[model samples]
Structure formats: structure tokens, C-alpha cells
Target: MQQTIEALRVALNKKRWHEARYALSRARALTNALPADVAVQEREQLSALRRMYAARNTPTAKKAQQAKSKAVGRAGGKKPAAKKSTAKSAAQTPKPAPVRDLGDRFINRANLGYGPTNEAKGSRTR
Candidate 1:
């Protein structure tokens, strides 16, 4: 119960959607303490908490907004970028970072050898 509440609260603070939901689910599972009307309140509280946490991390958010602006600028779309401020951008969804695949190399030793001697070199019976 206490563990569930704490986990849920942390998730709420982090803007982690699943965590907040899990917390609410676990809280209900543990105690079912909330009134039907209070569920909406709980969600709003979580949203405010996430907003506050994001505001505190605005510098990082600003850097990302600037980078996105640069990308748009390079693309040179006729649809000019809106001059909306940083606060608005921060409230928007965070963009997924571009992924660079360095290669899918692996040392798969499981199917390397097959003979009795190979098995012997691998593991011994107790």
C-alpha cells in the first residue's frame, strides 16, 4: 500500500503515464481508498506534478527546442515555423531521438560446437 502510493507518486512526478496508472491501479488494489469523484482529482494532481517537474528541467527542454528549430530551418519548408515561445514547446510532446545502429554483432556461442568433446569442453555433470 505505502509502496504502491510512493511508486505512483514518483511516476506522477516524472510524467510517466504508465507509472501513474499503475500507481492508481495498485492503490485501488491495495485499499480502494478513493471515492469515485476523487479519481479525477488524482489525475489532475499527477498532471500538475509532472508539469512542475518539467518546468524545473526547462534548460534541457530549451536545448531540444533549439535543435528542432535548426532542423526545420535546414529543411526550408514554406510553412514557416511558428514563433511560439519555449514554454509552449516544453508542454509539447518530447520528440524521439534519432537512433544510430552501430551494427548487430554478437558472440553467439550456444550453437558453436556439437560433438561429445565440444559438450565436454562446455559443462560437466555434477
Candidate 2:
């Protein structure tokens, strides 16, 4: 019974009207098996679910959802063109300095994997 109520709440929160209605019906069917006091509480919850289901299926709600979808271009409505901003330009900034390669220096110091030696392979004289 608790699980049924929880499932109904989850379905309602997710706006799954059919699933919520199904769960509500299940709750109603089990209410007869419960004690009178608990059954009354379950009946109140079922009534609230019924109200929510009706509200979500109302004509006004449907129209509002349709208008929202149309505004968002999901209902075949024409979307407004995006405006371009030209305040920032690439030519306004200065170019950065190029990077220098120092891998050859390490290679020369390591003497081509033969370990450190006195063999000067690079521009060590300069």
C-alpha cells in the first residue's frame, strides 16, 4: 500500500497522467483491505491525485502548453533570427610570441640515450 502511494506520487511529479491514474486506481482497490482510519487517509490522497489529473488535462492547460511549444519553435512556428554582435574583433588584439624548442638541448645533454657525456652535439660553444 505504501509502495502504491509512493508510485502514484512519483508518477504525478513526473506528469505521467496515465501512470498516476493507474496507481491511484490500485490504491483505491487496496483501500478496502485497510482499516477504516487508514482508508480515509488514502481516499484523501486519491482525491488529490484526481484533481491534479483533471487540472493537467484541462483545455486551458492544453492551450497554454501549445502556445509555449509554438513560442519555442517546437510547434512549427517561425523562430526569430539571431542577432550578431560585432563589438569584439580578432584584429583588436596583438599576436602572441612564438614558442621556442628546447627539446634538442635536453637530447644533446643526454647524448642520444647514451647518458651524460662531454660530447657537445648542439650550439654549446655559443
Candidate 3:
């Protein structure tokens, strides 16, 4: 329907790819059900929209978009404000426990009774 085609056009203009794609699909479905004479114009428009979408998805277009953003960022764009410190004094704040080296503890697993010990591996005599 013309409404769907119009929706696709608006979406494309706004760079709303998901909406544009949905609208395009709907338009295609509507166009398919129409007679050849009525569908020709819609088919042409659909092809043009497809090409536009494809162009936007290309690497060059992506790079250009990134460059545009970078330019905007450099041109007086608002930077994130630094966070203010809390009211708590340094002495009032609880210190985190120091990290211990547990590497040596796990090295001798048999001594730690984790794996089979030497006595456990040997044959048991009554």
C-alpha cells in the first residue's frame, strides 16, 4: 500500500533501518498482490529503497558515519562530567582485606588431603 511505501521512505530518511526493513517487506507484499500496471511503480521504488539500504550498509558509509561522529565530538560536544566524591572521610571508610597468595596452598594438593596421599595409594596391610 502507499502508506507502507511512505513509512519505508520516512524510516529510511530517519536512518531507522529496522523500521525501514519492516516497511519494505510490507510494501513488497502489498505490491505483489497488485496488478502488473499498478505494481510497476512500487517495484521501481522498492528497488531504489533496497539500493539505498545496501549503500548505507557498506563499509565506506560506516566509516563516514564514524568520522562524522568524531567531528561532532571534537566540535564543542558536551563531555561527561567527573563524578563527585562521597561525604565519607578516608578514616571512616572500611578498608578492603588484603589479597593472599593461595598458589602455594594448591601446589601440594596431596598434603592438603585433596588428592590421594602416599599411604592411600600403597596397599593396606592388616
Candidate 4:
């Protein structure tokens, strides 16, 4: 039991989470073999050790490990050529003719005297 505890402490001091977890489990097993009171005391110590090691294995460290593996994967292979899509683009469809503007047509009608006339010489019935 003492040997396992010493191993766990050494592993923790070295900031080795995996080894610390292993030694902690071993220590826990050893404690279980001892008297109930002694086992309870060791269990508390084991729980503290678990928390300490868990805190050290931070999310940033996990992200860094993931990034390293991805980098290795990218470096280890030639990526296959990207496939060209067989679907035709909208550019292939003929565009509809532009709308004929009416403003110019209205101006042309006024100039040609085909639009509304002046009231001065207009003939009308009331």
C-alpha cells in the first residue's frame, strides 16, 4: 500500500496523468485489502489525487494532441485529386431578354404629339 502511494506521488510530481491514474488504482486496490477505517482514509487520498491529475489534463492539451495527429495525417499522405462536379452551371441556360424600358417610350410619345394635349385649344363637352 505504501509502495503504491509512493509510486502515485512520484507520477503526480512528474505531471504524468496516465501513470498517476494507474498507480492510484493500484493504491486503491491495496487499500481495499486493508481494514475498513484504513481503506476509507486511502480512498479520500485517492479521490484527491484523481482530481489533481484530471485538472492537469486540460482541454487545451487534448486539442493540441488532436491537432498534432491531424498534422501527422496530412503530412503522411498525398491527398486525392478533388472530383469535378458533372452538374451543369446556370450560365449554360440562355438568359431571358432584358425588359424594354417604358420611360423612353413615354418621352417618345410626348415628343410625337401622341400624348395628353394642352387644354387651351382642346375641344370638350361639359
- TM-score to native of every candidate shown: 0.27, 0.43, 0.47, 0.39
**lDDT for predicted candidate 4 compared with the true structure:** 0.72
Model 3 TM-score (2 dp): 0.47
For residues 1-126, what per-residue lDDT tens digits would candidate 2 score against the true structure?
768988998998788878998997898789877777876766787778768767887899789879987776445566767876665664468678998876643335454575665654443522
Which lDDT tens digits does candidate 4 get at residues 9-77? 889978787899899778767776888776676678777776767767689767876898777655557
Best by TM-score: 3
Ranking by TM-score: 3, 2, 4, 1
- Model 1 accuracy (lDDT, Cα): 0.62
Which window of 10 residues has the lowest lDDT sum in candidate 2?
A: 117-126
Model 1, runs deviating above 4 Å: 33-126
Model 4 spans with C-alpha error above 4 angstroms: 59-126
Q: Which is the winner by lDDT between candidate 1 and candidate 2?
A: 2
The C-alpha RMSD of each candidate to the native structure, in angstroms, is 21.4, 9.2, 11.1, 13.9
Give the candidates in order of lDDT, highest first.
3, 2, 4, 1
Model 3 per-residue lDDT at 50 = 79
Worst 10 residues of 3 by lDDT: 117-126
